[model samples]
Target: MTDIKSYMEEKLLQFEPYMLDRVQLLQAPDSLKEAMAYSLQAGGKRIRPMLLFAALETYGQDAEKGFDAACALEMIHTYSLIHDDLPAMDDDDLRRGKPTNHKVFGEAVAILAGDALLTYAFEMVASSKLYSAEQAVKLISMLAKAAGPSGMVGGQVADMEGEQKALSIEELEYIHHHKTGRLLAFSVMAGAFIGGADEQDTKRLETYARHIGLAFQIRDDILDIEGTEAEIGKPVGSDESNEKSTYPSLLTLEGAKLKLEQELDSAHEALASLNRPAPLLKAFADLIAKRNS
Candidate 1:
């Protein structure tokens, strides 16, 4: 397989200027805009947008066709990270090896920045030249569902609630599926939908996303136990500190690792039916499970 990491990095660099320009165009208060820019530019993986582009390419679609949707995905993902680092939430001080948004911008500005990003995500999708009105509507609906109460937000709620409380394996899976998995799934599904993928292809992509989504969180749970602060760019063992329910909490270290491998394999199998080979997508699944950071 090609070097997926390098490929994704190249795409991220290509997308960065446009992403920044779009952020600057948001007509918000200066402080809020600055706060949003701070977090958005804080230098992370840009994995969500990369996945969107990869999925688009997998379907023989121009990556530019999904550019705005990719940007919207990044905005929503960044917003989640900002809120997650707040004192009221994860209380994280550092993100991407720098001060968290709340730490750099103050809590109020950070909160507004996150809000601005979330709302602006929809606007970006609505105004993009990439899709028809119908496609934009569908993309908007998918994104809203993935980011709202039924998806990422709901998972966040479950995650917070599960902290300090013992949870079943199924419950833990539910939390991950919503909290982290949904957006990842949405990223791929949105790409396929806007790329004009047929129903069968969309379903296969969804299956591929779902398996990798769960595996991604499981790998994260293991990473928290085994990875260093430098490797993860975040605190390790935060799950233990917060007494959060996680795959490792339920299955132990070795079991979680094995489960992650199983899910990665399943994801690859799902992708096998695609009309075109998705070497990058396959490599992404492997990288997510084995990532040190």
Candidate 2:
């Protein structure tokens, strides 16, 4: 597992130059460009990109072929974080052990940075040499749908609306599905499509991503209650402070842990059925459910 993590870190580092090069920082307004670079370069786990690479590896495809898709996914993820940390949203001041984008850049600049990244992500996908025209178009369409109103953005809206209000389990699921799950689902599914996975294989991978996505959020909720700021790189207990709907808020801490385990089991089962070895991805799912950060 440690070896896999190290390998992913190395691969992600290799992709960074090409990733940012796709966007013309010089063309953007100076302030916005600075802000975009700040947040986009901030050290994150690079989980989405890693998932894409792992999925490609599982399919015996060239991981480099998924590079553009991987970088585009990271761009979308970074944009979401910038917007999420705004005063109107999570109101967070820290991320990845550094000040949030809006905290360093003004709110306007942060918003613009996010907007720039979002649009640039599409540009990266469209212009990538990583896939055929048909594959690129399909990947772009899937990514746009996942990042757009019906996916991550929709989930963010639901999360904000549900705040300070009691939410049913189903409503909570809806929020997680769009907010956290869609991008994850897209990460795996896009890799499958790019790697030429068949319908049966793609469906299996989607199932795996969906279960782990929810479990990832559930673990996040638990971590908010149990993880330290030093470990998580953000203030702990923010969920409770904001009266946010979370797994632990609905279920006891122990119950939430149980649910997480159940989700992991389901995710693992789906992966196991694939019969294609994916130790790295499987380990990643476990890490997500068990991580302190």
Best by TM-score: 1
Candidate 2 steric clashes? 0
Best by lDDT: 1
**Residue 105 deviation, candidate 2, in Å?**
1.8
Indicate the TM-score of model 2: 0.96
Question: Which regions in candidate 1 have their CA more than 4 angstroms from the true location?
Answer: none
lDDT of 1 by residue, 1-293 (tens): 35886787678777998898997886767788788888888887877887788888887887788889988999999999999989999888998789999898899888888988999999999998878899999899999999999999999998898889899999988998999999999988987887778888889999999998998899888888999988888878887887777888789888888899899889999999887788778888888778778
Clashes of each: 0, 0
Query: Candidate 2 has which clashing residue pairs, if any?
Result: none
Mark the 10 consecutive residues where model 1 has the least summed lDDT: 1-10
* Predictions: Cα RMSD each: 1.3, 1.4
Residue range 1-293, candidate 2, lDDT tens digits: 68777877788778887676656444767787778878878987878888888888888887788888987899899999999999987788889889999889889989989998898888888987777899888998899899899999999888888889999888999999999899999988987888778888888899999999999999999988989889888788988998888888888899899999999999999999885888877988887888777
